[model samples]
Target: MIVHIIKKEIHFRIIKKLCVCFQLLLIVSCQTDDDNPTLPVEDSINGFWFSEELGYILEFTEGNDVVYNINTAGCSIVDDDFELEDFVPSLVSANDLILTTDLNESDFEFTRLSNQNPTCLPDQIADTDDPKVNFDHFWNIFNDYYAFFETRNVDWSQYESLRDQVTTDNFYDILEELVLLLEDGHVSIFDEENGIQIDSGFPKLLETFNMNLSGDFIIENGDDLGDLFGQKATTIVTEYLGGDFEIDERDNILWGLINDTVGYVNVLTMAGYGSDFSNELSTLNDLLDTIMNDISASGVSKLIIDIRFNGGGHDTAALDIVSRFMDQERFLYTKKFRLGNTFTEKRAVSVGPKGDFQFTGDIVLLTSPASISAADLFALCMKDLPYVTIVGENTAGAFSNVLSHTLPNGAEIGLSNEVYEDPQGVIFEAVGIGPDNQENRVPFLSTLDFEEGIDSGINRALELFSN
Candidate 1:
């Protein structure tokens, strides 16, 4: 592997390529069956509630509240600015607690810990250049918390031997090789102080997109494929939607009329809606409400919802947007976590109708490899509905809460520690949510397509609703 300082902008770009999945995760925990005996709501109100998905143990106490970021290496108190009311306490069972947060409508489910314990104390690992220490620590984290070794068909046990040969000189090389073996988009290693970051799956995905969709045309021009693709996607909206649209203040969502009866909504992300976390959900809802009213009033019988360019954000945001299309309550999806050999019970997730107007019209949801975590979740749930037709490529296939940990050498690492599935129990981890309509494949734009002013996805969607 190469040893170099990845640019600061490059690092942020990686973060952008990935999704802000943990905020949705920040709200969920290990959920078990309802048949388990229940505890009185008052008894389970306050204590250490473990969010297995987030790898955080939230200490909800009287007068004092705290959150701890945990991994096998140790525990660090997270300085999250969440308040008491942020977690409106409710009991699904004696051991199961839910926090109805104001950030999104999705409930934060937490499992009560029998005892308050962290993997170990922070600083327990010596802050030195000990390759073996860091190596072991890194491997152990995945051993204990990584949820998809079996699903990805990678042999974790096979990598154990690589530890003996790892050294100061070849540590990063070995690490890079290891990540490539895993092929998980959500798995990443970060050493900010050293400016070293290793992402397991994104490079391969981008390379594939360049080969398949863009035909390496952007690469031939010596421009960044991802960056150029985003610009073309934005331009495609203007090319197809007549260059007139309204966007939220942050530009996270864009909406306009493709035609009189066909309206379009392009969601770029599921998060970053407000200055304060307390009001984030409200800010998002207000924007969606505006979009909803416009669609309702226009009497659009066919709606094209484009999440092809989305970087994953909050689960609540995804569901909230999905809610605008639903006329009634419905089951959305399910998620769970892994504990060594065993797995947590499938926790069913559902969403209900929201806002003043719901567009229960013919819909086409466009997708791509850029559709990440929450974006993948959005596609998975939306495909379950009767009226929604997915008309693009598969999503990014990475749909778990990103769990992070620090090494003894102060290097940081993050990976998926949970599992997410469709409503019928199909795991979409290594494989993303694919389109339901297989025959008419509308992929993201190629450089050639952009040069010629063709927006195949929208054109194909328009054909679906033609009178």
Candidate 2:
């Protein structure tokens, strides 16, 4: 009963060495005279700029070349070289350089370091396939990059103590225990050959929902859904709506009008929209275009977005759906990342309507504890809209983007490194976002008798629309 959301591709120029390398030469030397005012000045960036927080040193040369040195313990120091394209320099200054790129419209500041050699110490883990080394490397990544230590109340030191007890044969189990302490649903470990080997805290909630129902039951009678619960739930919802409905099988959206006024759309999973992130986003936008156009043409006065069983997906896909309902650009939330051991400054994230078919009518967002990750973010963003009301249970609390890193053993580890907060600066990492109307408890699809009445959540939404 594993539900997977495709991790969003992180486009931070600082994190992507290849993009940074190409952009660095263009950015450092291509400053126009109008931009800088001083022409043909000597390069002030020629020297080592050390980031004590990241334990890395950047060396810029007069030749417009850059070298990056990563200081990791037990592993040989890693260096990356980038050659700058030919360009005339307009100005040079001793002030800290702020690198800006279109990859993310954010400024990365780097200061000059006076120390010829910084005191940054490398991790004691070697860059090898050894189980102990792999384990230590994995631990170090979280220690250095994971942002929600204090917020999640995770004591990473306790896990370090257990390292000595782990053997090659039992290391995977030990690692799972170690990560589960963080309680982050985004954290997982997968081998290229064996698929997912560890999912620390994600399966606990699924277990609570009794996710072991058979597939035949889910498809035939659409019942007994354990983990394959969403399809049956969706079927029940469509039947309750009772209109000429259409299910976009490829996009997994079921849309129709309820009582000739309320437009209903039930989105199952946020993943599988396309093969890749870009294609997926395009496909999602296209689907939204069709849905919004139909709703507009049908003259619906209200809309219902059901994400009760959404297991999350790329954050961009969530934003894509949200954009159709927004009329103006507004700040939705802020994202923060870990630098060294401390969290960095929060960056604002906002979205606005992109297409002509923006829905201005009242919106009812249906959610459940199963609505997670990107789904949680969708709820957070929509809740701020004046016309939107959230119903059903609290959403799955995880909201950070899952970042994947490959170990020397060819196994990949994914973890949440960013922290997202609502407009009021409230963090909902462990505790999910509560609905405006909680009277509607999420009905279990396995035990539901739809003939009796409509889903409590849907009824509440209808009641709100009537009022």
Candidate 3:
């Protein structure tokens, strides 16, 4: 249950490489140039830059750079000999710079900082390995940024009692216990150097599939839950799909026909498309162009889009895949970032008819608790469409951009820092996005389902279209 759940397609905004990765979506940086603290500025790239998304204070000097992992609790140097990977500027405005980094090779927009945060100042920087200091930083990181304590029905204060109990020997144990109490799929605490990665969400994710990868997710059997991705793909291809059946090289998408009448497309993930990460959207659009063209040519009257195992990726990729199924524009959902005790203004998100070819036929969107983050966003937007009927179980319900931080001891932590809700202001944080019809609900990889080679989600689509 504690195995670090890493995101295959790294979200550049988080401290992904610092610990491990977690599947996530992106959001606009929370700060503006106007929010910068007033100080002197250099017209060159060598200056202070701040990224609320990455939770880092970046300082660039002659030929060297320094990165300070920051949060409301405190700040600490990530390492004595650390530098931002491939930190070359791609764009520079008055006080803004877009720099490409090794995190998925994505260009990130960073706001030029005039001065450092008070907590990150040299004199105030937390540089000790004290377990209590690390504990304070860890607890405060959540106190300041976690957005779902109320929604998840967990009292954050409950952990205050453990603050006094923290010790160097029990530091990791205490942190792991606190992490599990939060019950968030996006939350993770890790010490890469110590080979310790605690994923609070992995057990539940495995439980949704009835897998025993953690000996606690569901049953007693022990198996790598990650294998289920390939197993599920193999089962669908060998047992149910036909026609131009094919899986892309990246294994992110699989498409074909069900009985050569109903269209079938399973998006295993929303991002990580091609050779170039910077042009990921372009690459995906081109692929979508080809797939939509084929679907149009195939003349399938109905479709089943199975995103049951999509853990998440970029939100853009999620929307790109779904827009091809719409007949018109739709106001999808809204998101708000976590401020101190409250949140920022809600931002509306929408999608319109996209791509040269559109599939306006009936669409059955198969979802499960395995569908998370960007996948949750995909389900939320699709739920608003009249032509699409969501089937299967509810989504994983963790919808937010993951914000990363580091403890005083250099341990990396990530937590949900935003909340996404439908257009009507309905949030599905812990409860998940439910199916429009569950009569067709089926365990995709359960022991019985797997042994019998069953994929009732597809069978349900066939049953619905036949009616």
RMSD of each: 6.2, 8.5, 6.1
lDDT value for candidate 2? 0.61
Candidate 1 vs candidate 2: the lDDT winner is 1
Ranking, TM-score, top scorer first: 3, 1, 2
Per-residue alpha-carbon lDDT of candidate 3 for residues 27-98, written as tens digits (9 for 90 to 100): 222222354433233346576777664566667787666667677777877644444432234334667765
Which is the better candidate, 1 or 2, if ranked by TM-score?
Answer: 1
Rank all candidate structures by their lDDT, best first, as comma-separated numbers: 3, 1, 2
| Per-residue error (Å), model 1, residue 170 | 2.5
Query: In model 3, which range of ten residues has the least summed lDDT?
Result: 10-19
Candidate 1 per-residue C-alpha lDDT over 1-467 given as tens digits, one digit per residue, 9 for 90 to 100: 00010111111121123222223134432233366554564555677777664456766666566666555655545433445443345567777776544433334456889777645234442356689877877777788788888888888888877889999999988988887777777788777687787778767666656764544454432135555555656565667677788777786888888788888888877777887656777898998889888888888788899888776766677778888888788877777767656777777888888989989888899988778877888898888788888887888888875666656676766778768877777888878987765665766756656667677777777777773
TM-score for each candidate, following the candidate numbering = 0.80, 0.72, 0.83
User: Ten consecutive residues with minimal summed lDDT in candidate 2?
Assistant: 16-25
lDDT score, candidate 1? 0.68
TM-score of 2: 0.72
For model 3, state the Cα shift of residue 212 in Å. Answer: 12
User: lDDT per prediction?
Assistant: 0.68, 0.61, 0.69
